[model samples]
Target: MDFDLPESAAAVREGVQAIAREYDQAYWDRCDAEKRWPEEVWRDLVAGGWHSLAIPEEYGGAGQGLLELAVALESLAEGGAGGAASFMYLLTPAFGGLTIARHGTGAQRREFLPRIASGELETCFAITEPDAGSNAIEIATRARLDGDHYVVSGQKIWISGVERADFLVLVARTIPAAEAKPRTNGFTVLLVDVKEAVADGTLSYRPIPKLGTNTVASSMVFLDEVRVPAERVLGAPDEGFAVLWDILNPERILAAASGVGFGELVLRHACDYARDRAPFGRPIGTNQAVAFPLARIKAQLELARLMTHKAAWLWDAGRPCGSEANIAKLTAADAAWQAADRAFQTYGGMAYSLEYPIARMFRDARIAKNIPVAEELVLAHIAQHELGLPRSY
Candidate 1:
């Protein structure tokens, strides 16, 4: 509502920017080409406490809200897409932390929060399966109670950070659809020990080769009767959909923020090139053809930023932000996609080259339009939830 960041928020944004400046486009380009994770830069973020900024102070985190988290993510992206968004992906476990904080038993929180806050443990979220994708109710992953532990067995695709994660905040069906209270019921959320799961051969993961974001590898993981202790379960069995929604809203908001930052980075590069590159003995920016499109991109990016901030605010205030978060992701993904296209056009031939950061951001931006939630699904949400239309699909 204020439309201005407070002093502490401003410092958080500025600090993230300063940290991101250490990695340049050239470094990001090399990492992408080599498909290497930015370990050193990630360590820098860990040491800076950037990874735990949103975890509660009582749990040894900075205890900031979603607005600050969005600002931090955007600042990282402002540095460059790969450079900034990598941290965003790395710190994704915090979304799980927030879910646990809100719903976990005191024992579950005590067991995981301190380690997560200290960066000794990193977590990957598992909800989107190959078959289920955005329709989470369709998730077939199953977790069955067996005395003191739950046996989980399922396959999850696009589960990021599994290679280095200490644990996973996993979602699986606990009751069959026929027995579920509603179509969304019968599911449960579990905090599984990654090391134990791997060591016992209950979980096997192979890195998913991806187009970008190589800093943290995505994984296709098979959970083969993995044993998650009863103490590790968060919230309740057969009622995780609500908790998953809370967790996902922040993920959407964070992704939208990173998209905003990436859009800004592309626009900045294009603007500089336009001001300096000459066509017809004058700056290319002099042509309305070039300048006008970039101007429109800048305007769109700002609008997306506002939507992202609004979503962040609502989530931070402990309000239901499903609609706002969905819209922010939809708008920001569109803006980033449009900005990437225009920025590439402004650069002409070089934009197609792997040497250019715009190309990488462009590829990454295209993914945002689909991953986490698709643009079509977001539009459907708006039509059904806000516009009072019947559900489609």
Candidate 2:
């Protein structure tokens, strides 16, 4: 029941916060307005060594655990420099590079890990398709083995940071869902070289215009006749479904941490406004309406933060954390959105102004409800796994 972060994590938080504080709200606002990647902010974070905190030491990473990385990400988000886009960019390594470290071959690790650890290479992951949003088993992407290469073809939507990435951790099926011995056993992950695929005209991408989190653009990707060497296969052929856990579990935990930090930032803004804005001879915070919602949101965020840490702890301990991970994201997502809503209400007209960060926080908070795993899907997992109910889908 230790509520505090360990000294190591506290040090990470301190370093991350120091870098984050250097970038002001206006800098983030400019990035959003221009739809530009926060390269300066990314460089600052990498310079702080937070980028390689979770990578194994042999691969030139610091060999830290999920707990340490989550603390760094949370601190970054709360610092007002990294909104949803920066948070999402930082998460790419957790989902992409960490998987390579865990399940990739010795050669595969040697080829990619060092570049990834140095932040010289950016990674993006693709899982969703035009047809299958959450159902990985139903995806239509297929890879055919041909001599030393696998020829791949499919369309992927809502892929984040594809343009910024040197490569993509791609998911495709070697065996069709209908033809496989087990539906889940038909998929495979490949480390696809983006520049090579594009150079050869096998891959094409177009940025998908989004509402918020514009710092990192999400895009639609097309792959046709893309050929990747067999050596690039991440794990055993048709066993990628199991390997995906290496990405998904950490993704949920980090996403939870991002939302938790966002909620706290929103509450801080709301509280500041409530304490200073006076309308009826006293600060608006004197009104129960303003004070109560902020109070309640603070309480909920505390619980959500605890669940986030617990999920990270279980994951770092090499224990099964499927239930905890799902609940952590679900809890944090709801709290983040509610806190944003309260802040927007507290600021009223000023919230619409770009000068304040509330509008951006509100827009970014909306994404947490549907990212990595949707709220409905998490509830379904809890219903089936935790409540002893039969699977619905």
Best by TM-score: 2
Superposed by TM-score, candidate 1 places the C-alpha of residue 156 at a distance from the truth, in angstroms, of 0.9
Top lDDT hit: 2
lDDT of 1: 0.81
Model 1, span 175-197: residue lDDT tens:
87667878889889888888998
Q: After superposition, how far is residue 236 of candidate 2 from its true place, in Å?
A: 1.3
Off by over 4 Å in 2: 85-91
| Cα TM-score per model | 0.96, 0.97
Residue 78 lDDT in candidate 2: 82
Which lDDT values do the candidates have, in the order given? 0.81, 0.86
**Cα TM-score of candidate 1:** 0.96
Clashing pairs in 1: none
